[model samples]
Target chain A: MQPRLVRLTVWAAVLGLAACKPKEAPAPPRPDPADAAQRAAAAFVHCVEGGNAACIRTGLPHGAFDAFVLLGWLATGSPVAILDALSRELVAHSDPRTVQGRFVREVERLSGPLRGAECSPVGAQELAPMVTQLAQATKARLEAIGMASADMMRVVEGLAAEAAEGLEGAFLVRMSCKREPYQLYLAMVPEGPRYSAIGLMPYLPRFLGGDEAQIDAAQALRSKSLGISGAAAPVPDGTVDRYLPIPMEEF
Target chain B: MFASFASFLLAVSVGLSSGAPDPQARATAAGYEQLRGFATVLVTHLNRALGTEHLPPFVGAPVTPGLIVTADPSRVQLFDRFAVPLSAGRVSPPEPSPECASKCPKILFDTFRRWWFELGVESRTHAVEVPDVVLIGAHRDLPAQTLTQIAYAASESRPIQPPRLMLLTHGGPAGVRGIPFYLVRPGGLTLPPNSAALGLTVTIEPGRFVVTAAARSFGRTLSATSVPELVAILKDVHRHHPNKAAIVYRFSGDVSVGNFVATYAAVREEFPVAVLGDDEPITIP
Candidate 1:
């Protein structure tokens, strides 16, 4: 009886400890969205570095706000990372709290197409908060759909330096910039009900010989060097041109 | 020199500390191929259920499908017409419309959805907080009559105020009897404006004996009153038009076929109507 009583006391003590410990149901695990956002931010920066901003803006026009957000995301990775990025982009004359406080405002007010068109795009003053939000939002959005962040990361990771014809409404427009030897091909994407800018018009720096025929020929040749067909618009001169049907081959 | 070193160190540290891998280094031939598959999947996911089905290869800028008004949701259909002419990647030479035909609920929605997803479109205002990429489809000056008509439409849509909406014309086929194409925006917005908005692009399909036109009426959430007014306008247009069909094409950003069929049938009792949910492609109905 004494040994059995001792065993029962030990079991009760263990049960009491189990009750004291907080037991949480395992939520379906989610990859930190912060990671995915950071990657997207990194990819945008890498793409920007590889291509010209003017050229990219020609496609995205109003500077890639998401990319800038990612840029901030990368800069202010955390409180620790913010020490460097925020310190540099921070308005020296302004209070640090004020600079930090500015993030509460929308990213659009800072550097969206509206401001870009109004000739008042985001500047150094708003940079700190913008990037911080970019990072946070990216993380939050991806986190919401446990799989969305991963999938988008894969998409961004897979992005090539060609026209962004991934979505259904993307197509190529050959713009005759009036007497320019090399016409331009605008990789136009759908902007709401209407279509958006001359986003993906790639320009080749090399002087083309007289024999060079097409508008995006140089870039086409370069893309060929990379072993790829020219993206959506490669200057169709005649009345009729070829259009790859929607859901274009991914690459 | 000390400042330079510190700057260099900061730059290097930032580069190193940033959590992303060297994407440039991985951007290779094989990388593109791997990316291609992933891109398809990612696009599919972004498009949601709309991505699952295969799209028939037709060669035209997006156009509206023939409309058939029916009470039955099952009877609703949408389709496409391809190999049409494209100018600046837009359907060209359309205003109040010059021509007609049938096929594809897509072209307009293709334009609408394309705009909906790609552009950082906010509500009616530029105030939508998004990465805005405003569409400035190469502008075509509106004929005075078309502008007058637009003013009338704006007044009808917003009865309390002077019409402040604007219009831009886009893609149509080459030849006689081309359709009238126009997209409505805020009065001051221009092609390549600072930002983009999700508005209604009304395309009066080139032919008759079908619906007269299509408009991007709503996005995501459909309303009972959202498209019926436009439907009435199309009927009014048909009354003036020589060729008349019984249907008009309408599309929204994120609505399903079943739900739209159910909703419209309940709300719109006047016409024998058919609807296209998000499940299928623009079929040749």
Candidate 2:
């Protein structure tokens, strides 16, 4: 009886040990680098689309103006040359009482709040009114800077209205805008991981061509898109079509 | 007894099969996809009437997405993948020259000031000298004759010293056109010892400068507010090495050319200087 009892206890102990043994946990999947980038890009597009002033301003990367200057440098020879030219232009109308000074002050007044505002999302209704106010103020300021042409202000107003309309439905894609003299390649690629939608500002003109030549170039760039969108069939190349009216399943 | 042991093995297999996926990781991935979906709903309508001519496509964060970049004009393409690295917008390293073979050491040439440059080596023990033949990593946009012209100019101006200066650059020669000539002056610049290089970034922020060194021997960054102050700091940082240290200058895109030229002049007035062109590598010790 004692031997049989000992055998029962040993078998019970083996069963208990087997039940309690922990399984090997699988290694966590490494997050895709593209996913994070795409997310950052999406956040930026949403900020712009929604007119979240704070998001837009905060999203403006540190060297935002630097790209502007460098793009100017491409045409003006050097950053110093552009600065000097600007200085000369400013000094020509140095009087704060002059139209130039008022224009500068007005621009400063309009832009200061946007620049210093906290990083937060604003309501949809809030942005459209603010943008219209900005557009009107901008038109007024242009007149101060001697751009008071009826045609010019009309064009500006027309453009502003069109812009508001364009924001109604816009999808964003990541295009690597590289200029000549490769270092400027950083023109759109930020220094660190954070994505800034404004880097695309320089390329927008090219993307939205004004002339036949500009249109051709824009078409060429669009042809290079990775056509993942099902709306348009993929070019013989593997890249997806440029435009997608509907959301993709990959998302 | 054998049947009991077999039952224990079956129990263990059941435990392995029951392991559940971590909830947190799945949630994070799902959140990323949702945000991506929200941003990607509608394509920016092609409306040229919107006066968006000045605006290019929206700038995107750096992403390669399995695309290959070509060598000449160095544009990114979808097909024809290769093993070249993509960093800070630079494509490939200078194709290793036959002359360099294993011994080739790269140096950063201020292609802006073709005459000025800093020397690098394959290793610590490598001997130092100026090579008569320097290779310019030209963009395909650059004419082929540009290489011959640069080589001829370099050969013509070989310094009267041993360790012949072979001036091969890791940066493309075309991009230097935008750099202000005065910002990187050619005069009074010295050839630093082959030991280590120091990095200095001139920024758009008024009076702010960031000094950096990548070596464990040196700490990462030193900030300075003025040219005189920057010079003093550079002097103090490299005091031990004295003239042995080289300065690699990186300019913020928005940095006023005047400020950059001032800081660059002050530093180069004392140490050898090379402006970083096209994502060139810098060394520090």
Candidate 3:
């Protein structure tokens, strides 16, 4: 079933945290993995909430931020992360108005168990102006290219109820892009006072497009037919189809 | 250059070679005339065996350059390793009729041995270069294995060769893993059959060096005899960084050279084929 994209000011506690900005409070230099995961998720959610373009440079884990750029290409083929590619022509000549405001309203809301997104290296300082130009001047271009719009961006979408999950690790935060053929899985590993979001692509560049329906149907059938209620249903086609696990007959 | 095949019909069906060396093979080293004929047959047969339908210098492995290959078979396809056919010309066979059927093993072994001599290989009387490695598939008997190694050593530049005597296992018969040799099963003479032995692959895991048998077409689990020498070689080569041909021979129930040919072709059909050394070949479940 196509999930309804409901806009809400407040959501279930389990829905996860958003921009809980505390003014002038710098996160600790080295946060624990648990703390880092919360901090990373909040940062990503906060940035997406306001189309916080700065997240690309300093907000998310440097590795995750870099991955966003790569994933953007696979997700939309729109060059949403093209500004961060450091290309001379696109960097200097591309407009920057659409992305600049994303830097604002990015106050860190560090409530809940999620913590410690402060340890990882923020992306290049030089990339700020370039990102600003892309976010603002090229807002439509960004959307056309599958860049996450400010409104559609959220840390956890649909109570984790409406959306299909790809991975769940002790420190992983994964969400599928409902509109496009992509999903991102980020991880929080031991590194700083906070968890490092290095190697975030568990389901690296997972494409959720044409194959999504087949995969979902197969999953649903397994969950329903097998009477597996509340349990995680394994993808039916492990060896064959990404969405469908091997046929029952093959068993 | 068209590859001339030294056709040796396996005199025994899946049975070992008859205990007789080919007179033609013996006479091959006798003079320059015989040398030319041997060279042609060796090159032509190897080129096809090695699947070098096109590569110019389609010199099959172990046999170095400086040797010539000819094919008197009019239907002979002159090609290189790349599968590209080369220029074809009518050439004469060295003799009136193809040499009579002789011991197939001795022919192949003798052919390789003659090439070494023609290549001016260094040889010692009492001590032939030691064969630190034993090719299980190449020889069914022990003595011929040693003798084959005698000529084979010139092909390889080994320092202190094993004594020309009984073949000793790295471990015991059960433990002995001879050098990695591919047991090319009876089929795969045509194309990459559902089962064609390609080569051996070694993957180093956490603490162990894992060796796997590779084939173009993989389905069934590959089986290999476990010998200590193979294991020793795997342990030895694991010390190092990791890592086909249609010769159709019609045969009946007769245990003639066809059986040996088909069998030898099955294993040696593809040289450099890796036999599981450190461990027995296991079927991937």
TM-score of chain B of each: 0.18, 0.31, 0.19
Runs with alpha carbons beyond 4 Å of true place in candidate 2: A1-251, B1-206, B283-285
- Return the TM-scores of chain A for each candidate in numbered order: 0.21, 0.28, 0.23
lDDT of candidate 1 over A89-138, digit per residue (tens): 32210232332232212221222211212111111111223233344444
Cα TM-score of candidate 3: 0.16
Per-residue lDDT of candidate 3, residues A96-168 (tens digit): 2212222222122211111222222211111222232222323333333233334222211211211112112
Residues B162-273 of candidate 3 have per-residue lDDT tens digits of: 1111111122223211222221121111212332223344332222333334443322332223323335544443233232221111112222221222233333323223
Q: On residues A140-194, what C-alpha lDDT tens digit does candidate 2 reach at each position? A: 5444323334543443444345334422222123323222110101112232544
| CAPRI rating of model 2 | incorrect
Report iRMS values in order. Answer: 20.2, 33.0, 33.4
Candidate 3 — which residues are off by over 4 angstroms? A1-36, A39-46, A49-52, A59-172, A176-183, A187-199, A204-251, B1-285
What is the lDDT for B217 in model 1?
Answer: 23
lDDT of 2 by residue, B1-285 (tens): 223322432443233223323336525653222212111111111011111121122121221111011222222111121122323223234342232212111221112112212111100001222122222222323222222222222322222211111111112222111111111111112213332333333332454777765444565667877677777877876565554334544444334323443454466545543333212333332
Question: What is the per-residue lDDT of model 1 for residues B1-285, given as tens digits with 9 covering 90 to 100?
Answer: 323333443454344335533447434422222221222222222233121121111122222111101111111111010122333322333332211112222323233222222111112111221211111111122122222222222222221122112111122232111121222222211222211212212322122112322222222222124455445654444354323222322333323222223323332333222221111222111
Instruction: In angstroms, give how far residue B234 of model 3 lies from its true place.
Output: 42
